[model samples]
Target chain A: MSTAERTAVTATRTRGLRRILRPRARLWLGTLAAALILFVVAPAALSGYQFGLLAQFLCYAMVAVGIGLAWGQGGMLTLGQGLFFGIGGYAMAMHLQLDDAGPGGVPAFMSLYGSGTVPAWWEPFRDPWITIGTIILLPAALAALLGYAIFARRVRGAYFAILSQALVAAFAILLIGQQASTGGSTGLSNFRGFFGYSLADPLNQRLLFFLAAGTLIGMVLLVRLLMRSRYGELLVATRDQEMRVRFLGYNPALVKTVAFVVSSVFAAVGGALFVPIAGIISPSDVAVVPSIMFVAGVAIGGRATLLGPVLGSLALSWVGAQLQDNYPSVWSYFQGALFVLVLGFLPQGFATLGGVLRRRKGDSR
Target chain B: MTTTRPLALEVTGLRVEFDGFVAVRDVDLTVPAGELRFLIGPNGAGKTTVIDALTGLVRGTGTARFDGHELLGRPVHRLVRAGIGRTFQTASVFEGHTVLQNLDIAAGLHRRPTTLLRRRRGVPEEVLRALDTVGLDDLADRPAGELAHGQKQWLEIGMLLVQDARLLLLDEPVAGMSGEERAATGELLRRISRDRTVVVVEHDMEFLRNYADTVTVMHRGSILAEGGVDEVQSDPRVIEVYLGAPLDAPTATATARATGRETR
Candidate 1:
């Protein structure tokens, strides 16, 4: 071969080698940076109030992680994550409420709103262990059952999205109507403690922040594990060509259901943490509007990537908080404009910005 | 060796209906093990539908027993699990995945739930073998969407091969292929069918004449003719209803009716 031909071959090989190596290295680096920032940097820099806000955002970020898996990777397009989040928050919130009320004492809201007695359904959550278990298990069971029914029947795309939205809407309405049992429209709030730690203490507040941070990291690791596994490839295969996967002696329904269950668990855990961080869980929080917001964050962040949902939700939550606190009324308009522009221009989200620019450069050649 | 290998596909009283219209009515067919059987007909001849019925894609009321397992009543995945695998006319593959990943996913019937959660340690022996068989080993890392039309069709075949299916049903495997790709696919088909029973639902008469061990002709749902390639080609019923028409010529009766039948 000529020297130029040899040089060209080496260059091509080098580029191919780099293509294989870069993504894995970048993934590890990005994960480490996220860990350092979340566990160390953020806590040190922000004040307790600001840190609490970040903690709340992390809960949403956790929910977004599942969305990234289900909607982004699995092509589920789950829009009712708020329902699971609400379930988790309510599960945790009820336990705390019971703890606050103490032995045999009904919560103040029940006596004031309706009957002076707790419902039979509210009885199990009095045990903290049961409450925690309920937070995880309920969403898993619900998502599995719901996902199987929908997927097995081959109801997908817009129909699935609409069904999810309707379910969340119904959940919100059910909570609101159950005034005596579920604290009515105000929902559950004013927690004195989490597990045993006093909520008012600054140290414990920081501990809660750490818990949120640790849990978010754990969830990311869990997602990374799923995305790398053989099931991950199957999930993507099911997403892109479901019937093809079905014809390969694998049930697409089962694969889809697994992702949905995991997504719900993530949202539920985030919601459970939100109870302590935000100090409230209401019907408005778990309704159609908030459910759509979770999807919006995933869409803006780039659902397909692991960190996209986490970073996207954090950005949206932070920006929304700033606007709500300062601009108030105009925040929605500005947020709407931003949403329209991002989806219009970068439909894959900000995660694909690097790729988009590189593509445009290639176009010039 | 011929007696040692069992029968692959046996159908009796197979009938399929959509609404009130019958697509395939009372068709019975069988192929001995390891036979490269071809099902050829003009459009709406129910050639693809017969494969679809056997594979459990469409709800067909009949008994299709493959490798001693009943196929007709089971779901698509269950039939696949029962050692039956099929491909589509418009090559179905995971567009985003690499060729290796596509094969790896297909070669996952025996993968336990626990092992599924871990990343692939290295290339599996079966996936590599399939890649070599499909002539896609060099392009293993390339995204399936980036492959040529012939390559995509080959990849689809490779997927079924990795699946280790006993009964392989291929629908129009070489549609729109250049002469070179067509010849290569015919050779590949012959290689893959040495042990496994392969049923090719094809249109290209040239391909069937060259490679098919046996041919089953369908016209208007039921079987028109069935025999060895040269024998079936000369059959008057097959020529009158099917082979006599220009290969690309769409019949008025077929075109005006059943446009939606091909999609499912």
Candidate 2:
């Protein structure tokens, strides 16, 4: 064989070796191991109520992970993810309502407040399969459309943030206005079962929590795989130097849209699961303030690190619950203070704490 | 020194307006493939503006044809896919990525159906060749943000190469470089131009005279002179544009010295 051919073979082999040796590969393995421990091993020790709380927290962490990808990595600050979250939650809630009603019967709420007629739009969700499909598709479709229009028009940065927040506000107002069909400000709740699994049973509740945990882990794994791909690098490139990415023959709009839509899907899935696990879906749960809180959790944890958003969201929610229990009025002040402190000092998030400590150790040596 | 190579870029009557102010006015230029052309002019003479217009970074009226295809309303990325590549005046690159990663991203430009889901092949042979061409193979793992200014410039050029760009539009590629860095860049530019058309917007007259096969001088948003470097240098209009006031022997030499690295 020619020397050139030999060199090419060597180059490809070395690249393969390099791919394995990269720090990201190690991190991926570590995350997988940790996920197993958290999802499979740790659940055995927790009480049913604690496990349910954990599942709900994981759902929030799921949304936070999406925030990290788009806001931290892709440089898209999606402040109104609650809109997609609401969409997913409502989709799930509507299906649950239909299932409990059992063929041609109006949901209990419709008889109570809504006119005794099921809305035409809610008809297709009667089938459990469509409900499951809509849980994934509805938010993805909306996000794709919104992302395409906004990104192609180059609406980004603070303007994009305001627009997204405005969308959430408008969505909440619309839900309120459609009180009869939507359950109004009260929102949809009182789900009886999930695909025939009785919610009243503690064992069934545990099963739901397991499903949420398993789905969250799967989503994280999917994100990890994507971040290692060529498209991941392009996403980061688009974030850092969009004009240069354009000159390199890439459509920045398409790349950003993909990231935004993926983020929306994650939020949608989180919201869908939250409905069953939390036993409710209300307008208040998906308002603009909740959307901002979602971003807050991501920012506090570390938007760029894979584990940061998950851990940060879990920690923030847990602490917020504790604070609300102990001193409800001061909880908001504490949350605001924490956000300010983190943004001011650890702008990269708490994930960088390890790196900072390591650097300091190196400096001393 | 002219060969029968086809024209890679043809622009005529191009004008760029920003609000009410015209940045580039009624410009006409053509570059044959496999040629190294220098665009030199005074500050704000619309050298970069013309490059922007051609690459579709700025909206302009007129005709720009690349390889027999009209290129007027196309987006920047489409122009890049159509074989027109560009580098910025300030050496724009993915600063967060490593040298190898930068090249890898550039090589993935032609990947289809979007970059999501499909994992692009890792560091193609072309990227390796580009890294070697720019003499940055050894520093492949180093973050690009930490590279020296000249190294960043070379990396950006390597990016264009890996994109298989047929027409390279470089704006002030060697600006702010040390003497040694400038010499190396000039050599690199000359070597890369052997297989593609390269248009460099520069301010250094001596470098143009030394390396440019053809030089086009812009004055007040229009082409003032175009020819072999020596011919354009000797042209009265070109000399007058350079000196601005009038062409006395001392003033001309002073202007040349002020532009830096004057050859004669």
Docking class of 1: medium
Residue-wise C-alpha lDDT for candidate 2, range B54-102, written one tens digit per residue: 8988898999888776777799888988888899999888999999989
Displacement of residue A296 (Cα, Å) in model 1 is: 0.6
What is candidate 1's lDDT per residue for A1-365, written digit by digit as tens? 98545655665565676687786796677678888998889988998778999999999999999999999888988888899999999999999998899978788888898779888999888898999899999999999999999999999988999999999999999999998889878999999988888999989988898899989988998999899889999998998999899999999999999999999999999999999889899999999989989988889999888778888999999999999999899998998998899899899997776666556556777
TM-score of each: 0.93, 0.91
> Each prediction's interface RMSD?
0.7, 1.8
Across all candidates, what is each one's fraction of true contacts kept? 0.94, 0.83
Listed in order, the DockQ scores are 0.75, 0.58
Tens digits of lDDT, candidate 2, A68-178: 889888999999999988999899999999988888768998888867999899999998899989989888889999998999898999999999999999999999889
Native-referenced Cα lDDT, model 2: 0.86
